[model samples]
Target: MKENIIALHQKNIAKGAEHLFLDKGFNLTSISDISETSGYSRRTIYKYFESKEEILYYLIIEGLDHLVQSIGDAIDSEQNFLKRYEAICACMLFYYENYAISAQSVNRFQSNAPLNMTTSVERIFALGVKINEYLSIWIEQGKEEGILKESLDVMPTVYILSTNLNALFELVTTKGTYLFASLHMTKEQFLSYGYTMNLNSLLKEPTK
Candidate 1:
């Protein structure tokens, strides 16, 4: 079927782009590179994506969706709040360590060429809204259970928590570098450091 072919092309393009990104990063990989690596004609590549940036955007979008889903599953599998938070930390740490390149690309994907395209911009915004909704639901559950502070508003709290967690992870893993390095720490090391900070921040009272 035509749809199946398109799907196959899209998957190939994604894999090709990811390979190039890991090797050369977003700024270096071109449409031609994607086409050649994917073994699709440039015209065929364009049939699936208007531009290379569109491909990158979709890649990042789908990657984050998978990340969010994993986190949701991890939290759902746990009973206690602390254990759930631990599971959440574990999930994030997994991505931070294993998929660091893709994660970093997401921040860049927002500012890149595809994001400026109206249709792609709308899709990115829609995905953000969905991601925020997931974060809000997670926080709502935490709040309802009295683990998260009672006065927290979902949207702002989710934004704050997500941003802070990213920064905290960056601080630990980045060492002294300005850019967060995906290579510096093992997953266990990063998780231990980041989770300690996370659990400490969540506490209403500090233990001596």
Candidate 2:
């Protein structure tokens, strides 16, 4: 069918563009680069995607989909709040380790790119909200179970966890080598310690 063929072309274009974006980064990769890499004309590329940012937007969506699924699976696999929280942290590290380009693409889009307010952008924000909601649910469950501090405000706890986790991953991704050299700790060690500290901060201290 014609629609199927269009989908195929779009897939091909996105595949090629993903490679270029990973290799050269989103900001440096151009329409011409995408065209040449995809073996599609610039006009054809335009027919599928309105702009480079739109293409990046779709890639971010794909990445976030994988992340959300991983977190969901992690949560579903364990009933213990602390176990589930650790699993979620592991899932986040897995995402950054495996999907480095998509991870970087997300950072770049959020920090530097101007908001275009496309439907794709909306989807990206929705996925972000979904992620936050996941964290909020986990935090609330912990509080109910007496695993997390009862006084911890759910939204503020979510905000701190999300912001600090992102910062930790971004730091490890961008300056991992420097950190290793300066701090004498591997990226894995750093992240493990960071996650442990974050977890401890929320946990209710056992009654003596």
Alpha-carbon deviation at 136 in model 2, angstroms: 0.5
RMSD of 1: 4.3
Check candidate 2 and list the clashing pairs. Answer: none
Clashing pairs for predicted structure model 1, backbone only: none
CA lDDT, every model vs. true structure: 0.71, 0.82
Instruction: Evaluate model 2: give its lDDT.
Output: 0.82
lDDT tens per residue, model 2, 59-87:
77878889988887876675577779878
- Can you write out model 1's per-residue Cα lDDT over 11-107, one digit (the tens) per residue? 8888888889878987898989988898988998899998777787777666677777877676567567677767776666567667666577656
Model 2 weakest lDDT span, ten residues long: 104-113
